[model samples]
Target: MKILSKNLIKLRDIKTFKFKKAMINYQHVEIVNHFMKKPLILVINCGSSSLKFSLMDPKTGEESLNGIAQCLLSDNANISFKVNGEKQVLALLPPFDHNTAIVELVNFITKNNLFEQITAIGHRVVHGGEKYHQPTLITPQVKNEIAKLAKLAPLHNPANLVGIEATEKVFSHLLQVAIFDTAFHQTMPEKAYIYGLPYNLYQEHGIRRYGFHGTSHYFVTQRASSLLQKPLEQCNFISAHLGNGCSISAIVNGKSVDTSLGFTPLEGVVMGTRSGDIDPSIIFYLVEQLGYSLDQVNTLLNKESGLLGISGISNDCRTIEEQLLAGNKRAKLAIDVFCYRIAKKIASFSASLDNLDGLIFTGGIGENSNTIRSLILNQLSLLGFKANEQLNEEIRFGKQGNINDTTSRPCWVIPTNEEWVIAEQTQHLLINKGM
Candidate 1:
């Protein structure tokens, strides 16, 4: 295998312009230009019908801007854009999807002069398949590559492309880049990603274990090495991102040698409403025995499953925990099943990584909910991981910190920063585009 250099590209002093001409901002300086050491970046993470954006300073590693467009297609579609901690809401017309939300977002930014110094725009694309393995400047070819992956992530990639297109229209002269959610795990070897199925199917259809949450995995790996004060090439860790969606990743020498999410986010550990790691036979069982259709079974696994289906209650981990405290048997069952699955997956990832340095918990459930963190680590005693209850409880809802003892493998609560990564990449690609 060819060895790729472990290079860290700094975005503070970068300026790139490709086919798109660079925006000429040589005259009037903005407030950001006064004491700025880092380039300003605009990042867009578009969901099925929602758009989440953030502004960041790559030099200072600070997230300095944020925006959210929720219920994008609803009658009450509105957007919340923030900067310097102050946020404003702008209501859009009826049936505003991601395509329209992005346009209005650009309008708001223009009216407020928010984009006065925005160097570039970065899009969080859900899947890049095996072709795009790094942050790519959005050109005709790059946009086509992202569009091809839409079949793999219909709910996400389409919306991502929409934002990319709309941004190109508005920020016509600025660099637009794509940072895929699957790029970080492009380091995985074929043996681990290949299923037991025939080789022809994979070769013909481009089907394999294409992991999700690459950005979250990337952030946690860096944080792990930082906490250990070890070079990333010498650090090894497992990252578990547990929210409405959950996936575990194994990091070896700063790369994702393996990951829990396979082919799609639906294949990982159980999530709020998504079934993770279910036997394929279950689908047949539901279809033949339960007389259910394939679409129904698909909905079963992707929606009406996991904690929601198991507990017969809400899928929110907090709600399920509250129900458990109220003596709900089904809720307790759901919580137990979720934690057990996470522990089991983490143990497997440890074997894949071998010589595990530590384990990290991010995402909503992983960062907060000390009970779940405690439960997960309790099952990990055999792996030399022990969390301090007091530390875990104290940081249940605070800034990122550690939860494990000093002598432990170095487990901690590192907050996931996909938006930050996106923003940084945006600034980098913008600066590099010209060169």
Candidate 2:
């Protein structure tokens, strides 16, 4: 009996040893797999004459490197970036195009030995039209479709295509994905997207509301959902992306139901340079009565308007704020108009939501400007958004928090991270494609 009991104990010890060994082996394999796998995503946002890039870790939302190549195809072209919070600027050779800028970016990445860990490239395509509501792998056909859609976003799609083609030439071995800024708002219903114009125009010409800043809106609204400890599908909020190009979205139950910007980004609230929501007759008046050419009118509205036009100062809100403090009446008026327009838009958007979870402020102006936020919220008192003045002032310079009084509905200052959204979506597409 004693001999039999000792044998049983020996067998149990062996089994426990084997189980511990198996766990160690499994952990070792996981660690090795993590190190071997390429985990970094290169996110690119291309403007007409600039290229912005970020090396991002999708899992942790960490940006290993961030940079921009500006003034491309000009003598003054330069690439500026930060590594480990240290800023550096390098001059690009003269007459460099987007392709050249990308080549330089690749060289920099290789020099830093980050090229191998970068698994894919994510490009931000400004307008995807009615076709793409999700991130897609960049194929030849997709490129052609993006080119064909350039007429709808003449200012952005061509530039975005340039970035894609440039990256294809530079990073041919890497899988690339395109994330559209207009994709999120694709969930908006027909009533929200359709114009009061003729039905044939909507069917044939596709001349209807396709909202911009969808990427930012999606990022902020999702963050709001997380912060509120509520499921996204149950949350309703109004997200205002007040940047150089501003837009407001009404997100109901995790989807964009209506937005401020329509047909073009110029249809929304007053922006840095855009003459938003201008009367259609104004264009005719400029051409027929004022002897202005159509090209000139287009340039005037898109370039020579907004805060700059109103203040006769800078288009930057920071500068406008400084001037306002110095007793500049036009600066004051510019800010007042900007805040008032946003407030009005917020109130109007409330009608879209059955219940308001919160009001989210994101983008440059929305995140940083406490004064503007206070002004906007003060105007929204009727909607139960009484700002806690102290809380409002505390949430700035990338600090996010709820800034509303206890008696009021939540008013949050959430910083939007569009690049992270692009990175995440890019990673998701790669996984689903089994790449």
TM-score leader: 2
Give one digit per residue, the lDDT tens place, for model 1 in 1-435: 011111101111122211123333322123234434555788888877788987777656676668899987899889998877888898878878776776666666555545545767888999999998888988988888778888888888888888888777666656678899999989999988999999997998878999999998898888888888999999888899989999998888889898888888899888999989877998889999999999998888999999899999999999999999999999999999999999999998766765888888999999898999999999998999888888989886646888997666678898888888888766666556542
Worst 10 residues of 1 by lDDT: 1-10
Q: Where does model 1 exceed 4 Å of error?
A: 1-38, 432-435
TM-score of each prediction? 0.90, 0.91
Report, for every candidate in turn, its global Cα lDDT versus the true structure: 0.80, 0.87
- How accurate locally is residue 132 in candidate 1, as Cα lDDT from 0 to 100? 85
Error of 1 at 367 (Å): 0.8
- Against the true structure, whose lDDT is highest? 2
Quote the positional error of residue 250 for candidate 2 in Å. 0.5
lDDT tens readout by residue for model 2, 242-348: 98889999999999999999988889799898889888999999999999999999888998889888989989999999999999999999999999998999999
